[model samples]
Target: MQPHVTTALQAWIASWTAHERAAQDVMEAAFPGLKPTPAPTGCCDVQMRWERDGEGSGTACLDDHGRATIQFEDVPKAAVGHAMTEVFGNGWFNEGPDGFAGAPPGKYCWEDDCTYAECEIDIGDDGLAAVAISYVKIEDVVAILDALETGLEAVRPSA
Candidate 1:
């Protein structure tokens, strides 16, 4: 991973941890009967793996709880649409913005029994393209993260 992207991911993780702490503090203050759930040591320390393919390279940032973001780099706008289609299925695409003559790009969400995910796209003349896959739900996230970690570690060192 690039230094800047790694830094950004670290910052993102820190923000999530701080927000969680703040929220828990408020809950504890409000409800004396509320029990604090102890997070495992270094639970916030995520292992990220980067993979390169013909389409683009991606970074999979996995937290211990199994939540993750597989962020693709330098993907074309058309490929982004195709990926979203694969995630949401054939008919689910184009359900967002029409991408008409003046309509701006759109964001769409997909959810199932175990997880919720979203895709955001930006299409314009600036020549920037990107795509991402986010995994939600605590258990599902953790399982996916663990599997990816194990698989990647077998092939290369994880940073």
Candidate 2:
């Protein structure tokens, strides 16, 4: 690579590193014990893994521009609708057979008038539901996290 290109790349990496550190600090303060790490994909700056003893596991990612996407796996299938309603509110629609336009059966999504965020809930063939909270601000990570936990708890078996 050219000298100037290398310098620019280094600067970008440094900025990204600093951003990740700041994001991790925010996440740690909000959700203790869940450490933030580099996301498996290049699209995101960092990812935090979450798990509840008997509930399920999930990952939350944040990008440099403060966009966040969270996914929860292995949740109760019945919770799919409840979660979608709780997190994204009413007026969800199916994306159709090809999983386009909206979301197909066993899946629900809220995409209209989402200036801040949008969310979806999908139940796989394995009988487990997955929740996706997208376009959320990283600064509101705590709020989204709380919403997700509450949505899952709404249908999870009581202890």
Each model's lDDT: 0.44, 0.63
Candidate 2 lDDT tens digits, 113-142: 755677676766765667777777776666
- Give the least accurate 10-residue stretch of model 1, judged by summed lDDT: 26-35
Q: Report the poorest 10 consecutive residues by lDDT, candidate 2.
A: 96-105
Q: How many steric clashes does model 2 contain?
A: 3
True lDDT of residue 75, candidate 2: 65
Q: Point out where model 1 deviates above 4 Å.
A: 1-46, 49-58, 90-114, 124-128, 137-159
Summarize candidate 1's per-residue lDDT along 7-26 as a digit string, tens digits. Answer: 99999988888855554443
Best by TM-score: 2
Candidate number achieving the greatest lDDT relative to the actual structure = 2
TM-score of each: 0.38, 0.58
